[model samples]
Target chain A: MSRQASRLDAKKVNSEFLTLTYGALVTQMLRDFENAEDVNKQLERIGYNMGMRLIEDFLARTSAPRCLEMRETADRIQQAFRIYLNIQPTISNWSPASDEFSLVFDSNPLTEFVELPPDLTNLRYSAILSGCIRGALEMVQLEVQCWFVQDQLKGDNVTELRVKFVRRLEEVIPAGED
Target chain B: MSTYYFVIVGQNDNPIYEKEFSTVNKELRKEDHRHLTQFIAHAALDLVDEHKWKTANMQLKSIDRFNQWFVSAFITASQIRFIIVHDNKNDEGIKNFFNEMYDTYIKNSMNAFYRINTPIKSPMFEKKSEIFGRKYLLS
Candidate 1:
């Protein structure tokens, strides 16, 4: 049983046209739930579980080097989005301290046909993206807070994901070393 | 976008290998959904048997349909069956994927260290399956 579960990593090799199905799932979940916040929470939880599993597949496929700096990590993440979803998010809006940055997506596959209804103003249609980033980063020993500050589905010009470096897990790096 | 549930059935109608090709772990985890897919796969087994001798070709395009899902079947010379339950249409892609998998199965089933008609444990097999699956089916 466990071996079968482990073999599931094979399925994560592709992510093309996946968001449409994911969108269907999200829409289904929206109908099931009365509150948009709860829907967001559900989507986040789903993305978290997906991230925890997908990181292994990502690591195996990409063989990306261990990132010593978060800046490099952001670049690698951009590469990942490009590879998996065929979207390259521009890394911008860096904080002065360099502990935070925003990933600006000019085109998001998830929101291609998604339109937020006026009734569900609080729904983050793609909260799963944030949860996925958080969970994938956690596997690499990074404790980062990630969320969507702007979404195209929510009438934003573009989709922007904000990631904040909280603290590194199981590490004791001295300050000023970046 | 489509979801494919692929399974390889060995002798005695036993499942030797299985995979669900979709965005992994992203689907809403309702317990009944998977059970329904499984049941559809099982229900199509008798249909596969009924159609096995109808065609001379190894590939049996699609044998059954359960609502939105379609069951496609391919059989080996030794009667090992590969079944895929999917939500959309892509006959060419599924045929290409099965051909690729059949090649790997030939190599794996011939291995001295590997047992016949049992679970395939080779990393190379899984790697090629994923690569070809993405190439032919999910592209």
Candidate 2:
């Protein structure tokens, strides 16, 4: 199945349509919302919804076992993005407690065609990416807090997302009451 | 000929996919008997839970039995379960069936339209389930 999945993936996931569609969606959201904060929230909401299901597809394709620790999860997230979205982000800036780290990417496909207006500096164009990460982690019984700290679109050298380990959720086994 | 009933369970004991592969004639197969198959599958969830954490292995073979019927379970890493209720014991074949069903379940879940924990209503899923049931159970 992995062989078939990899073969199919090779023919799939061209970024042109995805990039343009995201661009259009953000533009429409920007127009619909009164402030940059609302627009960023909308983007993150969309990404969170997708992320809930994305983990299933990711697990199905990769059959990845559950990560033993937060550090392992960071590496798995990077690997997953590389395989699915074709982005290679480096993990750095670990907290002394090892509970937080940052994902640094120089070229984000979602931003390749995006240029933010100066007034919209507070708008996080890639908030959806962090939302997706949080949503996917929740499904695996891991609760995390993810947010954008820097954006190249805002003239930063690289895009950076700070991910903090909040707490691990315990799997709630059904009581079979139903 | 053994009759087999299978169910895929998601979180909160929600049954996502269910099927019966029966060699018995429809007219001869009583409605209560058919319902009994499902009830047995439901009753085994507790046993499945008890046995699942005992081993890291996915397949908990022959976890429950009722009268003559036996239940086999395969728990995914995400805690979704594939369960089988059968009158005859064929451990190897049941394992093969669970593995195939796991692949099919994953493919269905990967569909952008399909959610991880919901009833699998796709015709393709039904068709593949039938094919796998025939290949692994009746043979």
Candidate 3:
């Protein structure tokens, strides 16, 4: 699915609009939350909510089949990000157990001109993406932990996120016994 | 033409949101039918659970029938279940209604203040849902 060309044409939007709106949102969140951690949590929560909805759009658009393995899930995410965001991240550092993997993004549009202030250096500017991936995967019953291990804003050449599969959820049948 | 009851069930089997509307052509009822509609919708949940594992698809169409009422369901991958009960059976229209409702639910979920399993109190959500019901299910 990752190799196939996207059927939907990319909708063009003014980059300025995106940058300005996102920047304002972040600024307002920082102001309202006061604490950087709280801002991060808020951002993640927003992303999680968005992800819960986005997966539907993705499935409806792509009609991609369910992923049976973690590796396939990684590919699906890569394809989804590429098609939607137009940024392809390198999937690497797969654990022997195949329960964890890292996505290294050479360029992240979300952080194009985002420069974290020295006081808020701890802020993960793109943490929302991690939260989105986590929330979307969780909906598919793949319980996983997603976090940014390396961020370009933090002076790293590549922004990387590590996803660790916690466990697979068995569908709890409410009335299994006849 | 018949009355329609919509219910959204959370992953924990809690009622997250619900609404009742009759066909646009029919006169709206003044009687307090909320409790009865809720009861029928709640009873259908048990049937939804029993049938959920039987099929991989999300749309559990016409799962149960009580008198003239028929239940149709659409379960999101996140386990948020959108169920609709009505007298007339129009499978395609019900599917479209659920799809639109899913979109609205997603938009509601995107709100930073909103949390899972909580009743949706957003006026915007309520308004959109009403519009969808009128446009698709009612008409």
- Residues A22-66 of candidate 1 have per-residue lDDT tens digits of 766777786789678899999998888888887887777667789
Indicate whether candidate 2 or candidate 3 has the larger TM-score: 2
Residue pairs with colliding backbones in model 3 are none
lDDT of 2 by residue, A34-152 (tens): 77899888888888888898898888878888898889999989987897788999999999999999999988988764556556778888889998999999889889999988889
Model 2 bad stretches (over 4 Å): A1-3, A173-178, B1-139
Q: What pairs collide in candidate 1? A: none
Chain B TM-score by candidate, in order shown: 0.92, 0.95, 0.89
How far off is residue A40 in model 1, in Å? Answer: 0.5
Name the lDDT value of residue A124 in candidate 1: 86
lDDT by residue (tens digit), candidate 2, B33-97: 67888999999999999998899899999998999889999999899988899999889988998
Pick by lDDT: which candidate is best? 2
Off by over 4 Å in 1: A1-17, A171-178, B1-139
Candidate 3, residues A1-178, lDDT tens digits: the string is 3333344554656655565567678877888888889989988888888788788788877788989899999999998898678789999999999999999999987776565656788787777898899888878888889999999878899999999999998888689665
Please report the interface RMSD of model 3 to 1 decimal.
11.7
lDDT tens per residue, model 3, B1-139 = 5678898999989989988878543345556566877888898888888888899988888899888788899898898999998888788888888989998887666543356689988777889889988888877
Write model 1 residue lDDT over B14-98, tens digit each, in one string: 8888777875456564333566777888899899889988989999998999899999999999999999999899999999999
Candidate scoring better on DockQ of 1 and 2: 1
Give TM-scores for every candidate, taking all chains together and pairing residue i with residue i. Answer: 0.49, 0.53, 0.52
